[model samples]
Target chain A: MIARLRQTVWSGITARVRGTWDSVADAIRPAVPGFGTVRRGHVALVGVGPGAIDLLTLRALRCIEAADVILYDRLVEPEVVALAPRKARRIYVGKEVGAHAWPQPRIDAKIVEEAQKGLRVVRLKSGDPSIFGRVTEELTAVRAAGLAVEVVPGVTAACAAAAHMQLSLTERGVSDTLILTTGTCREGDPLPESALHARPGTNTVFYMSVRQAARIRDGLIARGVPDGARLRIAADVAKPGEQLLHCALRDLPDTLASSSISGCAILMLTWPKEVEALSDPTVATETVAPVSAANAPS
Target chain B: MIARLRQTVWSGITARVRGTWDSVADAIRPAVPGFGTVRRGHVALVGVGPGAIDLLTLRALRCIEAADVILYDRLVEPEVVALAPRKARRIYVGKEVGAHAWPQPRIDAKIVEEAQKGLRVVRLKSGDPSIFGRVTEELTAVRAAGLAVEVVPGVTAACAAAAHMQLSLTERGVSDTLILTTGTCREGDPLPESALHARPGTNTVFYMSVRQAARIRDGLIARGVPDGARLRIAADVAKPGEQLLHCALRDLPDTLASSSISGCAILMLTWPKEVEALSDPTVATETVAPVSAANAPS
Candidate 1:
């Protein structure tokens, strides 16, 4: 299969296929026809999962297999990009690991520019694009230029991290709400404050926030989040070199500073609704009711 | 590929893979050795996406293809279940479909029973199992009995619905936080309160909440969520008969009552942080700045 992808991608026949394939999460909207007989190319803003090839959704894979050009981010695995047809063009729009890297604006221009040439383009992102993927800029740019685009959702890192720990992000009584927020904000925008977030009865995951660990800790503390709130920090989620850490909210900064995960890590805090203090001395260190025989009622 | 899955699954090669597979998000855990060499079966709690088969993650498809005994819910598409090996036992534990339907507690018991028999059990749920999938009960049950289990995450419903609409769920300047909560609670559990949730500067998606439309609307309104806040309601996301509605928070109940979508629907509302009011009379009907050229600053 890998060899086939290479052959197809490098096959030297680069003709765009227009919605010919079935079962790949067909574009929700029909393509708007271009005026004056000018052919228009299609772009698929596909998420390739947190890191692992296995986490890649079938729809995302299908989009790559049928692409005439693939513009991928650094988070996408090289093996995944290798799956495109041999006759396809591959471009790197990520911050690292590519000879032909481009920034966000350039990517917007390139996607619209390439589509105008009537090529099948795939803008591959890492994880689901809906969260912290800078999706607003790209979607606006594409739609502004009157081209057809579709988003193929992929498994986000939080889910992958939860799965890796063999735990769920939200539990029945422990947490009824799940928040998908980011540690960092857009340039020139105000940094996210914990006072505005960090709800009780919630499991909040902060993406791209490892660098702001201290700020996050202080902010949550300022917002009156319990000092002993449970946090699950993970990096390189499903990819090799995976690291998992369990600590209290107060220990987050020290724990991360001493650990190896950087930049790519996700910070998840579970602040259970005010619950009875644990009477069992064995597990007294934790706050919420742990998912054990001791608390089987939840 | 479909034929290959059938062969591998139905081939009666039921011996557990035991972390032998190279990829496929190979369980992040090592097997706990059973005492006295009593062979133990494994259970994989897999999320099969909202409804579409293509939205299924490769890791999930791998689990299903390798399943020895498959227990699937109603939200999972039939084609997804059909991919399991013909020899593999396929059981339905859903309330709406199949003759072998069983309730939640029975499922917890059944999963433990099958895994103890040394079968590779796949407990398939719709959407990401981490969110409102009742994972606490299931995971606790499996572990209490000293069995091994893993979770394979899939694209959750909110992401899928956002993708289907060709829009990003979390857009800059418009919505900073994304909350994934549900409308209904457990039989004895207290219902989720919008006052505790429904924050400004947040985009909240309610899963399995169509039945609670009036309650959700009333609660949000009472909590100061603007009556004209933009809402996007979608049902049967990514599957046939998919329906989408865009309305104000106040009209949610009435709009849902007049729509074709019933059950299996998600409701999303974006209550922006206090922003400057628009002067244009045409699109003034909306509270937040539109995503058009008029509001591209975000």
Candidate 2:
């Protein structure tokens, strides 16, 4: 009887999905919601995962093992780059600000140069390669140069950070929206209007924004976001020197200062909807009293 | 001189990270940022990537191999569950609607029961378990049961969809924000106020929402989201029967109706900051010209 009703309700929905999906309407899901395209290719863009080599996806490992040359970013640990065969040339294309830094275009050209040589090229990035990783530019370059390139998705840092912190990026009703955005933009681009997007039912994780901590905090405060919008600062997540710290939004700048944290950090700003602890049976006992989520019964 | 200048500029930045970090100020990073906590545990919450078993992180694979009792969701492929040792118990905790469904509480209790028996319990969820996975409830249950639990992150479906489409979730200088939100809520919860959060510079991926396609499309149209806001839908992403389709926002309803896509899909709604194709040198030639992002020079 329920199946009949469900079928009637979902007349346009595919029966295959409806059979397995409770949402019956849940038409879509993100298999790995960052990036993927299985194309025939000589060059591959691979996300090596955040910090831990163990976190690397099987696809990433396979891509690395098959590479004849690897152009890796700075955050990619040497140990990860070492996964390439001994004969593979490991080029350090780390984009730090010093003399060793390769500008975005240079990195693009180098990848193209190697791919044009008919060598298997791996453009290794930390975390999922498609988010805030300037992948479009490289992707554009590879295409413009007439090389077949494929992107192999890997564990993004945000997911890893949340896992390490024992936190969920999106809480059911409390935080229905999860936003991943960079805290900083291109050097000359206008500072991201980070505070402008705030709304109920939204959680934002800022990537590459620690130096702008003070400004970001001020913007959120100026925009009247409550201190209840707690800040979770995770540093070197999953790396040996990882640090997880929590504070109100107001303490963001100081937390980074005193925490001895380095780079590759994400600032998770969440304001889980307030719920009455006495009235809500689903409120977790271990959650911070003010910002706890209501795991309402389904 | 440049190194010294960079050093002076990065006075507060951790030397360890700055040596490897370009931002020098990246205070925290997501090393697979969905959900993770390394605790002493017999119960493990494992995210098994979106679909493909090989997409599973090394950590997730390890957790499954070590399990004495594996409780998996519906989206988890049988090949994945079969990875457990022959003696391991494979329990189906998938909460599909209908008589066979297991309530969330019962599933939690089952896990607790298994753990109390000194069994290695693996709570396997597809995609990253931290987002929209009802993990908090399960995590709470495990904690309340006084059992040590660990959450091993996995590649989410969003990453997989984007990769399959050869698209990036967040584009620099354009769509800097990526929002991951589900289409439907629990049976009783209010419909997600998705349109209210629409703003420039944001890309949203709607998970488990294909059933709500019409309503969602109506909501977006009502909220005045332009047709320029394109929709890319990928169904059964990375699975054997994966399908990738694209349409304008107004056409979302019909697109799904016409496409034979089943479940395990994600709706990727992207409004890449409009760029003048002629002026933006870095704009991808292959990108839909109207929705292309300005790959602005850094």
Candidate 3:
């Protein structure tokens, strides 16, 4: 009986969102009243994708439509922010390129204060919140302020870029593990030693580390990572003028150093099986000659 | 012009589904079609969240409704499978606790073969495909078979479980990073070292390793993880009979050792600050006493 009722409500939501889904009108009529108004104190932290509104999830769209206030960041597109109810107040807490626009405490206070006012605020962010989006902090602060929070997951730029490029982060016997890290940490800290020693089967995703690409490469090499690993840099994934570069780790620093590509890029180090399968056999022969010379114990 | 055309198509779609979304129906028309249809040679890897259909993504729900054939595993609920078009063939490739149903190689072959026939095949997984679902392998195989594949992201078990418990994985300075790793590797390989050392500012998610909780706890302790860190285990999130146990790593083995909680589960290790911020301080001081010893230094 509960299942039947749920089915009705589900269909109702669908029908309410898209007329084509109205074929189940008979199944949806009864559940309409229950979803009338969302409860107050409920917060939806939504990912707005790289910069395109098209990549927004349907739930994210619905949640935004119902918001009373939208606390958005600089990275979110103007078009996507426009989705919030017109009457809903829009607050910008986005950080400037080099400066921290809004401090952490202020953002937390805003969430708590708005939620206290019984507003369903959508804390809009760019890409997936689980990554370096800094959602964990805001959600923590809000919860501490005695409010309810719901995270509506969004597509991360890494996934979007990978999908756009038809590249697999992991492949059988090639790369079986994926590591996501941040490159925004200060200079002296080099790549984490353990991450540097990631098994050959692993792929690493470095977020917000575009300017530090050369350092990241040097750090990885210092940690004993092979110079021959395949590295790809994806910037502005999903944006109209998005850029991507596929090259070897040794050459990546030079390939991207002088390039004008900038802003919130993801650096992916992958051992693609396709490349291994498609590489010119003569290239492998050349690589082995040098590798054997280096490995020949003195 | 393209945006307007897309809006036209979307408005038509929204009108067909929900009639109109409030007074601004004109402003928020469908920019794209609802429930994206799978094209030939394209595999939609979807996650049917825990067991509850309400937790399923609106897009995932539509894909399942329109699937030509659903290749599902044991983790997917029977009710979700029933949602597929009545005429859609349902192939069970799930592995029961002790029974080896269909090996992965066979499943991959079937997906490739079906796609080759131009059938819309949905590899319906229980949780997020990018995580432990091994959708990567399926993606590689299908693409190798000369078919297009698109992964429809779903609510990972960790997020669902966290949502069920109203917990935040990353809370401010308490936890800045969220690392997701399986509890145990197949064939007795050691637990991931990163998961064990879960840094002071990181949250670790363990999937499909509930049975080996004791070993996992031991590994963490050996890695010098602080005893004060917070640990939470949620089994069968969003489903009936869901269970959540928030404790320290050491106490987990004893608490869950004798009991068998099946289905999907998520083990989260978070920083103290994040936990303190997200949890009710009063409730934390009371209910968490028993497991306080979990943080006792090794």
Candidate 4:
């Protein structure tokens, strides 16, 4: 009976000491610049940019290094995750096209539970988290739990792909507007109606549209996009084995059929010949193979 | 006469030695990773991102460090320019909205002239060099001069503003597409017709649009966009004095009039009420004050 009473007293003292330590740390955080001020159980949604470790912002790297728990997506580069402290717990919650290792609700619950214990949590995503990142659902759940949250933006895939090709999404008197859309939708969800048509003097970039190239081709053609319009397809941008393919709008399907590209591709429709002709002649001729030669039933 | 003859002969010897050194360096550059293989007098068009030093990619930093001369835009942060070597020549070619300090053609000629002198050049721009960056004109001139050129992408203002708000540009079943356009055009250049309308399930971000808020409001209203639609104006995004303003589409003109935002602002149109209601309640209530309360007749 005496030993049991002693053990209870020791446990009480330990809890008090930890509480004191946490309070002291909180007091010092405000004085340090770039130090995470995330409240006990707060979450930071950080964008790591498109695969290049150097693209990570200083604020993002600071937050990752300070996190106690990190949940990362599959598209995030391994080099980026290495920036986290060695003692921090790393969890992989990546969701593939047909496979979701940890469903959305479960991931949300895990973050909240960890935060409740007063641990700093970070959810790392590839590219800018605001673009097709399903950030709304996660933000809703975290805020509903009454936890503090902040977002750090990173470079998206479209920007990286454009950099690779030395191509601009907008040019004076050529293309004044840029549109970002996806050709594929969820199983029961239908594609947006506006995406079915292409507007003149506008550059359109379709994310995750490689699998539906034929459908995209037909939709654009039906909406009066000329068959001879120039298009660019970038696969595995900013990584080893990166490939860039240029073709006429009608030959996009054929180009993909001959190539082995299954993941992380972007399709961009650029300005017409009239505007392109005014630009560099070298760029005009880089990939200007005859349409008949590219599509001659090879 | 003897002194002049000695000077000419010394210059000839120096030129020959420099040529040999450049040939040797070029031969070894291809074998080194991250080392630029730019021939002497080549130009690299690099995007430095939206003013944050950490937002600079590894490739961009490397290029800057290796440059003999750097021509930077006004929007690029000073912290980023500090990354260049101390001996590198820094040139300010900033172009303000109403002030054309250095005309486009002059800037283009300067870069080519420097390259012709066999100096490695880096043309730095804020945000992605391709999007509304007038890259085609500069690129055409550089290529016509027979110089090597490459482009490096950076995070644009739209992505940075969305990140600052912790809001996603594309959400499932809400906004499936994102459009980026400008509100003001050059003299005699008409605004694109389709940009005036906000499509359902599409999020539109207008760059350099704060000064033209009244025109944007009238155009959208005429195109069937509801006056009650939610709008966000982000000023000086990702900068030290960054500010975000939330108001209805009808109040946008008044909001800008009341504030001191002239340039470096992004206007974003989110999803409609019906879709927003289906999402988080906190987001719904965060900026739902009555229009009259937000803008009293005082």
Best by TM-score: 1
Task: Report the lDDT tens digits of candidate 3 across residue range A192-243.
Answer: 3223323334566777767677777776554334566667888887665678
> A22-95, model 1: which lDDT tens digit per residue?
21223212332431242358889998888877688767876888788899877777877877878999987776
lDDT of 4 by residue, A50-89 (tens): 7766566655765786789999977887767866768999
lDDT of 3 at B249: 60
DockQ score for model 1: 0.20
lDDT of model 4, residue B238: 70
In candidate 2, stretches whose alpha carbon ends up further than 4 angstroms from where it belongs are: A1-41, A274-298, B1-41, B274-298
What C-alpha lDDT, on a 0 to 100 scale, does residue B21 get in candidate 3? 23
RMSD of 3: 13.3
Cα RMSDs of all predictions?
11.9, 17.9, 13.3, 16.9
Each prediction's Cα lDDT score?
Answer: 0.72, 0.71, 0.61, 0.71
Question: How far is B7's C-alpha from truth in model 1 (Å)?
Answer: 18
CAPRI-style quality class for the chain A–B interface of candidate 2: incorrect
Residue-by-residue lDDT tens digits, candidate 1, B1-298: 4444433432222112112332212221233233124235889999898887778876787688778999987788787788787889998887563475677899999999999989889999898888788877888999998988899988898888888887777776666788888777667888876434655467788887888888887776555554676788888988777888888777888898888788889988775544322222322221211122221100
Best by lDDT: 1
lDDT of 3 by residue, B80-144 (tens): 68667679999988666568688778889999988888988999977656556667668779878
